[model samples]
Structures are given as structure tokens and as C-alpha cells.
Target chain A: MSDHKIDTHKIDTHKIDTHKIDKRDWDAHPPYVYPDYKSTTFRGPTKPLVPIAHTLSELTIPAFGHEQIQEFDNDLTINGRVDGEPQGERIQVSGRVLDEYGRPQIGTLVEIWQANAAGRYIHKTDQHDAPIDPNFFGGGRCVTDENGRYTFLSIKPGAYPWGNHHNAWRPNHIHFSLFGMSFASRLVTQMYFPGDPLLALDPIFNATADKIARESLVSKFSQKYSIPNIALGYEFDIVLRGPAATPMEA
Target chain B: MMSNKLKQTPSQTVGPFFSYALTPEQSGYNLKSIASPDMRADDTPGEHINLSGKIYDGNGEIVSDAMIEIWQTDADGNYLDRDTPPMDGTFTGFGRCDCEIKKEFYFNTVKPGPIEEGHAPHINMIVFMRGMLTHAYTRIYFSDESDANEKDAVFKSVPTERRHTIIANRVEEDNIVTYQFDLHMQGDNETVFFDV
Candidate 1:
């Protein structure tokens, strides 16, 4: 381990001055208590969320190095192979992680998990009645490059049924978890496939309210990144919250 | 290429299947987890303590699929940033634990110090689970630091009765210190969540 010492006395005064940064775009986010999503009824807090100022605790985050990710970490098609490939329509998902200011967020750790082509998760709790693909573990991780670009080679996830309501089926999607530069920059959201009919009926998808923000969750087909005779490609860029152009009252 | 100003991707539930990916080590995967519950190293200086808690839904059942993450300053009130190297390499001040099998989450880390003069020693926490439409943000303040807690600007913002919900109960057994802080998703004493 390197013996580099931190200067505890010299605090970042700039961060202290910019404590009143912009809050997240609440209009773009789903309300904590969207009644249509049944689970939110019991899980959502009854009181309003307490807004607090940004501090060193929110501005600084743990840095993950490139050494942590493995060769097949981002390739779901190969990571869990068991004598043969997983059965599904093979596809490639690529995107850039950027801040709201359009600046790339380098070295961000991006993680994804999804159901297999049969709409079944590898987890034991999933009782969707669909067959679980033995060769597909349905979990992958990748670190964004200097340009904030990341790609994953995997099978397209299938729509799955849930117990939320009678005959409830979730739109096909891949869960994404990202950790940007700070605690405030951390985000966990699902990426949906464009033009899926189920997106219209999914309560969770509609919870966001805004049409544009809801559409932002869907990834678009990209012929540019698609490999000939191998797999189709989809692009889903993520924009995390950025510091305000002008300070707001704390 | 998209426009410079872009809308953020909306948050979705973590659902019940993240353990295998986010906390792979605990889920029996060969892949290593990016962050673990243990954040302390032998050379790290501080009062080592075990912070453990269970997550409960409105029904009061243990949330087995919940994952809890924590970020805090070191014992000396210094947060880790890329620009400045940490005094202790092993103390990253970040940890992740999922309540999959045990129905509880635990972190073995040193107690964090106050980041500012009026602030109390606290650990920033986030809760992600299957039922939650979006992850919840909260903080863990030490009950022992009542003096600092009384003066904390953030802690003071919470309602008087609800303030106790964010403070962890301290216990010591056989020279080992432990802080117990349970999170209630709804009903009764629901944890005070922050928008920040």
C-alpha cells in the first residue's frame, strides 16, 4: 500500500461554499409515494423528505480502481457459460456515463442484473414459473473508461410476471447501478427496451409522471454499434445530477 | 449524439435479484464484491465498532432482499477523495452489506468523527430493496454523542419525536462495541429519510 498522507487541516473550502447546489430534478423522478405501485403504499415514508445541504460527506466518495474488474466481468455471455452459451437473442448494450453538464464521469463503476431470456432470475426468491437458463447467471459489472463509455455483451432479458397485481408483467429491462464521483452522484435505475408495449401498463414505469423523463429510461436501437451477424446493439446514456449553475438557498 | 442538457434516467426498484451482482461474494459467486462490510484494517486507528441492523417493512417483517450501503469520514473527520490520498490505505470509509440470507445487514467499521464543528459523528446510509420504488437515503448518528447531536444542524431539522429514529443505540459486550440501528420502511417509527 502506498504511504500517501492526507492533509486533514486543509479542507476543501470550495465545497463548503457550494453547499447549496441544485437539488435533483424532482419532476423527472418518480414520487416516493406513487399509489399505483402497491409496494410504495407501505414502504414509502409518510412525512416529507428532509432536505439537507451538501457537505464533504456528500462531495467525496470511494474510488474503485480498474484492477477490481475481471476480463469477462462485462460479458454476461461468457462469464457464466456452462459447456454452452445461454439461450436467447444475443445483444450488445453500450452507453456513456455523464453528468448533467454533459461531462463524462470517468472510472464510474456500473453494475447490471436482469432476468434471463425465459424471464426467470437466478435468485431463489423468483417464482415466475419460467425456466432459468443454467448458463446465464444474469449479473455483470464494468468500469467506465476515460470517456465514460461502457459496453456489455449479453442476451436480451425477457419480460417477467410479478405479484404486484393480477397477471402483472414487468417490461423487459436491465437493472443498472452506478457510483459516480460522490455519494450524491450514486444512482440505481432500470434501462428498458424501446417500443415495448408493456412499458405503457407498467405502474413502476408510469410512476415518473413526466413523459420525457419516462422515455429517457428506454434505450434506443443503435445500428452503429451492432456487430454484423453477431448481435444487435442498444444505446442508453445516463446523466447524473450535477452541481447547480447558480447556488440555491439551503 | 444527444443534446448537452439531458434528463436523468429514472430510478427503478433494485428488486429481489441484486445480491448475485452487487454482493456477489455473499451470494456464492466467484466474482468479488466491490465493497464489503469490513472497512477496517489492522493499522487503522479508531474505536472499532460493529454496526448491525434489520430492515422492516410496514408489516414489520424482515426485508430479506434489502441492501444497505454506508459512507462516512474517518475517525479524524476526513473523507476519502481521489485528489487526496487517505492516511490509511485500507480504511476507505465505504461499505456495502445485503440482508439476503441472514435477514440483517452488518458493517464492521470504526466510528466516524464529526465532519464539521457543529455536526455530530454520523454515517451516511442508503437503503435499496425489492419493494422500494426508489432507494431511500438516511443517516446514522451515534446516541452517545448527544452533545454534538443536539447542536447538529441536520439532526435539528428533524422533528423532535422523529429525531430518535435516526440515532443508533449503543451497546458493549466483552469489550466489543456495537451500534444497533433498525430501519422501518413505514408505519409507527419510520426512519427519517433525507432528500439530499
Candidate 2:
């Protein structure tokens, strides 16, 4: 009903009317729909970390992940802690990209990155770096669409060494990054594996007290999609720091 | 002549940022929210979304398969069923979509209301894979004229230098608020994430 027009020079949203976007799964407990709130905060402008060289003209995509790109609920179902006690294959990652209020502008981009099967990076800065694999190239990136779905395929990384002390090696892990549509949503963090004994010894992994909370990043193995030994699957749901105070995007 | 084997000189994105992990201090933080395996995972309602865009890298190259995630408060500024306000029903707040996908990944969600917290409204976000980290957290806010984005607080606090990453541009034709979040590590402009 508003006079605002959609932005051009980009792909059109709402072009396909048939694709069914996922709905919010409410709690089974007592239902309580709260009152609606209107936000007054104005969106500020953001500059590109770099130049927008990949314009509408040239769009050359690099191959990533496996060939199977499926929906989270349809082909790839996520069974995280929300179900109470993650057992099978579950990864934890939470945060909100909103202000104190719940209103969130749509169309903001988000991305994540991590190590490969060998736990080595393409850079010399990585202290515990290892020999890079010839066939297995790890590392991927994605953006959020209108429905807020971002995805990428990465190899199941192996643990790496850190200190010379006996058994001072670290377990497998991944790094994360966020680009909010608003300053409120911007945030950065990491996901960790669960049930690893190194958690107690590794200083980086033990920065917190809630061991269960840190282990939320570890992905689980689902029998349905689990390949005997081909590959391991994981689903990590992330919540950006939104209108809530102490937003990370800034 | 002796044969020489060459090591694959991965792309520039193969920096230390991609190989980093979360320090223990970040447990309750952004990517560590569902840190515990006992939490419940809700299904983000599916609707219809016509989102489309080209992937790019730090040097501005098209980086395919960049996974993206969007989270926001519902039409009423309240998360879907988060609180048990005696007077209201349930309101759960959670939504996700991977842009690396195609038009099939669409949704028709209502514009959410401002929250009671008295701050500007916002949409929580997360980035999937970019050679950098596992999961990235951030926010998405709208310009003032939009109903759902006005009252957000986190959207206001950002310094002018960091505003663009927060608010998105609205496309009147599609009736959608759009913003492109280009995530970078150790770059000129980096995403601001929580330490949880």
C-alpha cells in the first residue's frame, strides 16, 4: 500500500509466487500472541568493505560444497537443542539482529566460513596450519535472500595442533562473520564442537563457564541423510544481535 | 628436467580469518546461542520469497554458494511465542533463507511491529560459509518510512561510518526491504558481532 518502489540493479524479489517460504514454529505451550509494536529507528547507510566490483554485468560463480543443495526442512532438516538434549546431529548458534524491539528490516546479507577436512587455512597467519589438501578445497560463502535463508557447503574439518606441550592440540572448529542490514544486526563469533576433552585444556574454547553452551556449534549425524562414511552433515542456526542493546554490527 | 608438483594456491579469501575459532569467552555469544545440545530447534515458517542476487568476494568477485540466514521479530515486534504474557497468545520469532538458493526459497511474512524495549526495530542475521568462520551474526533494519523498522534501537546507535551495514533499501515494486551484507575479516570495515 506504500508508494515505495523496489530497488533495481539487482534480482527481483517476489518474482516466483509458488515457492513456499517456511513459517515460524510456535511453542506447544499456552499460546499468547503479544501486541504489535512499530519501530521509530531510522536505517543508516553502510559502505562496502570493498568495492562492488562484481556488478550486474559479470557474475562468475565459484564452485562450492557438494552438488546437493536442499532445503533445511525439505531435504536438510535441522535437529538442534530447541528439541531438548541434542543427540543425533545438532549444531548450536543463536543471536538476534534487532534492536530492543523485534522489528527487523528484510533483505540484509549474512555469511559464514570455516576450515577444511585437514584443519588448515589458505593463509600463513594460521599458527596451527597444516598442509592444504589437493582435491579437497574447503571454504564457502552465501547471502540472505528475502526469506532470510543463507547457506554454503564446507568439508568436515579435522583437529589441529597448537602447542608443543604433549596433547596440547585443539579440536575441530569453524569461524563466523555477519553483515547486518542495520547496525543492530551486525555480529561476529565462532561455533565449537561438543563432547571433546580438549575443551577443558584449550584456552580459546574454555573462555566461558557453560560448557554445554559452547559445544552448541558441533554438527550431528542424521541416519536419514548420514552417508555411511562419505560425509558428515550439520545445521547451524544463527541469531544476529538486532535492536537489542550491545549490537555487534556497529 | 625434473617434474615439479605445484600446491594449489587457493583464492585470496583463504586468509587467517577463515581458519579462526571462537574463544571460550564467546560461548553465550552470537554463534554459540544454541551452544547446548539440549535446546529446541524450531521450524521457520515457509512462505513465498523472490530474493535474488549475485555472490561476490572481498576483491569484488562473484563467490558462489555464499550461505545466508535472516531472523527477525514477527509482525508484533514480539518473537514468536517467546513470552507468556497473560493477556496475549504465543508469538515465536524466527525466519531463515539461504540466498545461495534460487527463487524457490521464498516466503510471505508480515512486517513485524516495534518491540516494547523502546529501541529501533531490527532483524537478526547470520552468514554461512566464506572461507572465514563457521557462522556470522548481524542485524537488518529499515528506513524510517517503513512501519516495522522505525522504533528499533540498535539501528540508531551505529556511527555514521557503520550505518550502511545496518539498514536496507526498500524496493517499492517488490514491496521488500533489501540490504546486501558483505562480510569481511581483518578488512577495512568488519561486521560487529557479540562476544557470547
Candidate 3:
């Protein structure tokens, strides 16, 4: 027990030599977690409110099978949708999970959720004018293959009206959840399409302060990934924390 | 080798918009998974307990839109790993719950067995809320396990004054054990959240 004892307060957020690379500034891009964003409610307190820094015990080492058990097929439309099919233009989303150094992250978990083609969620709280899809549960899970690549087939989510502003609307996007290797590797983000008119107006997307980091959230169309007469392909690669850490949701 | 020049993507919060798919109960569907907030069996060999608490922000106001996820070993100090199966099929060792209108969340689980020697019984917790871009991690140690808590590696790392934040109050009612632990997101006496 003595060997395991650590003085957590003596530890610095940065310079923690462990499996987790010290990335203290990674919290900057996240809006609600940092005090920089003024427009959002419950923003992190400005003064006299300091968040406790990370310590050794705080870094959870991922257990075996943590990212393995619940893996579904690369195609979400197969087992997730209500009747093996969902209405709307079927699109293929493929990406690689990588570390900040661009090294492949294999056998990692990637979960996703989104709105139906009608821009409405199948939720009791969602009272939007748009209709909910009976077939689209809008959620799926998959694990990165040996090459750190993963793929999902689903309908393109529609832009929906939000109450944030007078008539604010969220841009077309898909929610992504990834647990790369440890608790420090966990990330939840949204993937947006290119050239969306609402991207500029959306507060969440703009919450990221760095222009380059925000642009990374947008997926690009790829001719190589296109399925000829079938679904269009969009490629997005995710990077976990490190020197060039991904600016993730705090 | 590839140049590895592709930039990394930024992250966004799961937000208050995940109930439909992530939490199917709010969507009028019953999808069961390891994320359920209770992992106990009536016939299992251990003390049955209930954990209840409220989530508060820096202003001491309730955080109405919050979620809590807990994981722990079975009653016999055994974790469910790839090679180590549950003592029985009933114990999954994981649970998840979202706070309702009252800004309160609770979990019904058995007292976790120590994961390793010289450690007190504790339940691992992860908290997710609307404003939080990422989840917060903490552990719930049993206040009654004074001896074990004293030598526990994790508990020893916490400052003496702040250690109480993670120790739950044990109470018995109608022959049932319940642990009360309120989580403070910020402010003085804020619950200790780990970066994990």
C-alpha cells in the first residue's frame, strides 16, 4: 500500500509522466467547461472557482474488453434501425482513430447518435414541429479495425430548430463517442458536413476558439470512398490527446 | 509511411440532446445495456444498498440536466474482466442514471468488494451534464470502512479535509442500507472530481 501512495496535491496537471500525455490547454476549446464562453448558461465560474487538477488516480487505465464487447457491425443501418432500413439518403461515414502523433488507435470503441432525416429526435422532450422517424433510433456503435478505421451507414441528419436564439438551427451533424485507450482517451464530439450554411450561426461549433480546430470537425467528401451509384462517402479522422491534442469537449 | 499531417477534430458536448438515443427511457423505449444505474441481485452475496444524491453547480443551485454512471466490482472483491466472469450471471458491475426534474440521481447497487488488496470498498463514478464538455470521474468510498479507508491507496491520496466529499453516509431504514452522497460541481467543499 505504501508503494501505491501518492501525494495528489503535489502533482501538476502538466508533466505527469504516464500513459496520458500532459495536455493542460486542451480544455480551452470546450465552451461550457471553460469560463471563456459568456453566452451559455452554467458556464464555468469566472473567479473564486478553481477546478481541481488531474492526478495519477484520476487517469483510469482502460480495462481489457472495455472497447470490445458492444461492438456492432460497420453498418449501423443493419441492426440498429427499426426494420433494417431507414428513410433518407443513405450515407457512408468512415474514419480512422488516431493519436495526436497520427498513430493508429486500433480496437477502440466509437459510438454515435443523431437526429432522423426530419431533424427530430425520438424523444419525449423533443417537441419540435418535425416528425420523428419510426425506423431510425439514431444510435449505433462500432470498434476501430486493425488499421484504426471504422465505418457507419446511416441517413443524413437534418438541421433542426433550436431555442438558443429567436430561430436558431443546428447544422447537419452526427454525434460521436470514442474511448481510445483510457479514461484520458475518452472523447465525445459531433461531425459536421462541409459547406453547411448553418455552421457559421451555430454556437456549439463556433465554441471552439481555434479556427483550425473547429474546421477539423467538418468531414470532407471523398471520391475514393464513394460507392458508385450507392451512398456518398464522407471521411473524418479523429485524434486523441497529445502534443497536438484534439480540442475536445471539456 | 504517411506524413500524419491530418489535423485532429474538435470535440463537442453530448449536450442535453442525447436522451432520445443514449437514454431510451426518455424516448418511451426500454433498451437495456451495461449502463443501467443498478447492478445488484437479490440472491447475490453482499450487502444491498441504494445511493442517492443531488448535483450542484458553483452557485449551489441544482444541475437539473445531469447524468451519473457507476462501476464497481462484485461482492467478493472480484471485477468483471475479460478473463474474470461475474460470480454469477446477475452481477454486471455497471450502471447509469440521469437526474430528473429534482436534479437528483441515485443508484441501487451492492457494496463493491475491494478491487485490490489494502483498498476500501468503493464505487467508481462518472458524471456528465449539459454544461460539462467531458465527464467528471470520482469514487464513492464507504464511510463505515474506516480501517480499510485508512490504508486505501486512493483514499490516502485525498487531502484529509476533503476526503469526506467522496465518503458516503451509511444509513439503514426498514432493513435496507442506503448511502447518501451529494456532488458539488464547484465552490467550497465541491465534490472531488478526477480528470479521468
Candidate 4:
């Protein structure tokens, strides 16, 4: 057995604020059983979730190193190309990852996957009747720098049809996954393009009841980051859960 | 300085298309996954065991597109910090597995010791799938650790009747130890999910 001692002091510090920790705002998120999203019927849990304290397990997460990410991993336009350049309008997506305290979450990992410009994914499950771009694989990943910022170059994803409703078509969006400082900070969300008319009709996007929270998922078009005649730029910032505020000593 | 105005970025579903990107290996992508089911190296300490389970939806159908990630303390009950080097360089106590192909997820790692007094040895898990808007958080506790589980505060927080939903049954065959723990999203045997 290894002789590593358990850090009792550190464990105690975390236990003190277990009850006083700031709870996540469930009001801002969609309920588990939103009927409009047809799949939720069989997937959403029926029992009330048991609230528990954040133990050592919940406060820690595995660290992802820079070595794991390759040079072309962040450039989807080039990394997945097969024969020639992907046929689509290239765009750049850049943003900063921050905590609730507004502090930069440096060295965090951010991953993105989306349908191709023709609204088709390079997976066996997606049988969308769109032409697959041989050049576009539609996936990329990058680690946050010192300023908690990451960027990816890819084509603008198109809207896709689903069988949710009679004529359900998802809005143009990209799936994003982030690993922040702690397990509580992990987030898997989708970033939607601004000014998509489908935003009003999409059940998944409208799941979040709060108007402001739902709007926050939309990335704003940025001229400063856009390259002339190359790729348009869009900025999407993410805020993770911060450490709970400890009560003052009596 | 903290800003109250800075609300969290709302969550969205991972959708059915995440396999090609997140769990590339399972989906036949040439790229490597950041974390895999193999969490232990050749020399990692403690009793190495395989934890495997299938996730069932409300209809009791297997969730083939779900991704399960687990975080646990090392065998010595030490939660290694990002900066702390382990006794063996490879044991990170983290694992990620996708059920896209096999319809079940499995992880190989050493059984964790208790983190502190009155706590049970357990693995924290998070579930992400295409249908769920947000991920579900759950923990895996050993059925063999009844003494510790009874005393654990977290276990006590769960209703008595529902506490069994979180325990994993242990089975051994030919020197290989495996823990079977299935998760139910709905219906009769729904697993106890926690909000942390």
C-alpha cells in the first residue's frame, strides 16, 4: 500500500461549506420531463433527485494536459479534410471560459462536435439526407490558454431535420463540452448561431424557461475576430460553477 | 471578485452525434480519447476490479448513445490534485466510457478506500446522453461495504427504501472481480440520482 496520507485539513475545509454552498439555479434549466422533447419521456427520471453534499470526489476532476491535444485538433477545417478543402463558408469560433466569479478557468478542455455544413454528421446514426462533405469531419477540441480562451475554425453548420414533431428541424448549432476545475463545473451544452428563425420553434433550445438564460446560448457575431475574405467570427463565452462561498467564522 | 449577474451558461443536450467527437475510439475515429475505461497501470496498487453496467431508459431499453464518466479516490483514499504526482505515474482515478457500440459501459480500476471517517468507499459518476438536457450525477457504492455504507452521511441522506438503488453487487470468477451496477432513468427500479 502507498504511504500517502489523507489530507484531513483539506477535507475538513470542504466539508464546512457543504450545506452553505450555493445551489444551482434549476429555474434557469429545463425540467427533466419536458414533453415537447419526445425522447425525455423514456429518459427523464421520475423520482425527485436526492440532494447531497460535495465530497472530495465531487470537488476534484482529472486534469487534461496540453500534450493530449494535437496541433490540428482545433482546426476542424484542416484536421478532417480528406481530398480537398471542405465546401462551405469557413468561420472562426472563439471565446473565454470563466467561472461564476468571472475568473478565467485556464488550462480547461473544450470540445465541439456538430453536423457538417449540409446538416449531416459523420456518424452511422445520423442518416440525414444531406451530402456528406468528404473534407469535413465536424469535430474539434482545444485547451484554454492563460486567459481561459479557445478558438476553432470550421464551417457554419446547417439546420437539420429530426422526427421529434411532424416537421421538426433543429437550428444551426454546435455541441460543446467543457471540463472546468471540479466535477461540479463540467458542462455539456450547445452553441446556436445568432438570428436563426428556428430558435423560436426548436424545443431543445426553448427548453430553458428563462429568456435570458436561453439567449445566452446564442453566439454573437464579432467583426474584430473575423478575417477579411476568410472566415467570419463568432464569440461564445461559458461560465462554470465557482467554489461555494464559505460562511464567516463565528 | 464575484459577480451575481454572471449566471451559469444553460445546458443543452449532447445529442446523438457526440460519438464521433467525444468518444472517437468507440466510433472508429482515428483520434484518441482523452480518458478511457482503463484507469490503472500495470503496477497500480489495490484490488483491481471491473465495474460494468447498462443504462436503461424509462421503457427499460438500453441507452446506446449515453456516455458515462467516473471519478474516484485512489486506493489510499487520496484525491490527487492536478499538480500532485501519483505513486504510479498513470493512475488518474478518472475514466470515460461510451455505450454507442456495446450498449453498456465498463471501467477497470482499483477499489477506492474511504475518503474520511463515516464515509464509504465510492465512485462518483455523471451520465450524459442525447435526450437529457442536463447530465445526471450518481455514485456507486459497494454492496460488500454495508458497515461503512450504513454510517455514511450521504447514504443516510437517501431514503431507506431507495438506498439499495445505489449499491453495486460484487461477483468474482477465476480471480477476476467485477461489480454489476445498472442505472435506470425511470420506471420501477430507477437509480437514485443526486444533486451536488
TM-score top scorer: 4
- Candidate number with greatest lDDT: 4
The residue-by-residue lDDT of candidate 2 on B13-122, one tens digit each, is 11234321221112121132211111112332332122223433445444433344444455555444212221232222333433322411222344445555554555
Tens-digit lDDT string for candidate 2 (A94-171): 222221122232444333455545666533345554665443323333444444444443455567775425556656
Docking class of 4: acceptable
lDDT of all predictions: 0.84, 0.35, 0.68, 0.85
Between candidates 2 and 4, the lDDT winner: 4
10 residues in a row with least lDDT, candidate 4 chain A: A1-10
Candidate 3's C-alpha runs over 4 A off are A1-85, A241-250, B1-9, B25-34, B58-61, B76-79, B82-92, B101-103, B115-119, B146-161
lDDT of 4 by residue, B30-131 (tens): 778888888898789888999999999998799988999999988889877575646566888888888887789999999999999899999999999978
lDDT comparing candidate 2 with the true structure: 0.35
I-RMSD for candidate 2: 23.0
Off by over 4 Å in 1: A1-21, A247-250, B1-4, B85-88
Summarize candidate 1's per-residue lDDT along B94-192 as a digit string, tens digits: 999988877899999999988879989999999988767777889999989999999999999999999999999999999999999999988879899
Pairwise lDDT winner, candidates 2 and 3: 3
Question: lDDT score, residue B53, model 3?
Answer: 93
- lDDT per residue for candidate 1 within A1-250, as digits (tens), equals 0111223224333443334444677877887788888888877677788888777777777888777798899999999888899999999999888765555789889999999999999886788889989899989989999988989999999998888899899999999999887788778999999899999899999999888788889898989769899999998888787554432234
Give me the overall lDDT of model 3: 0.68
Number of backbone collisions per candidate: 0, 154, 5, 0
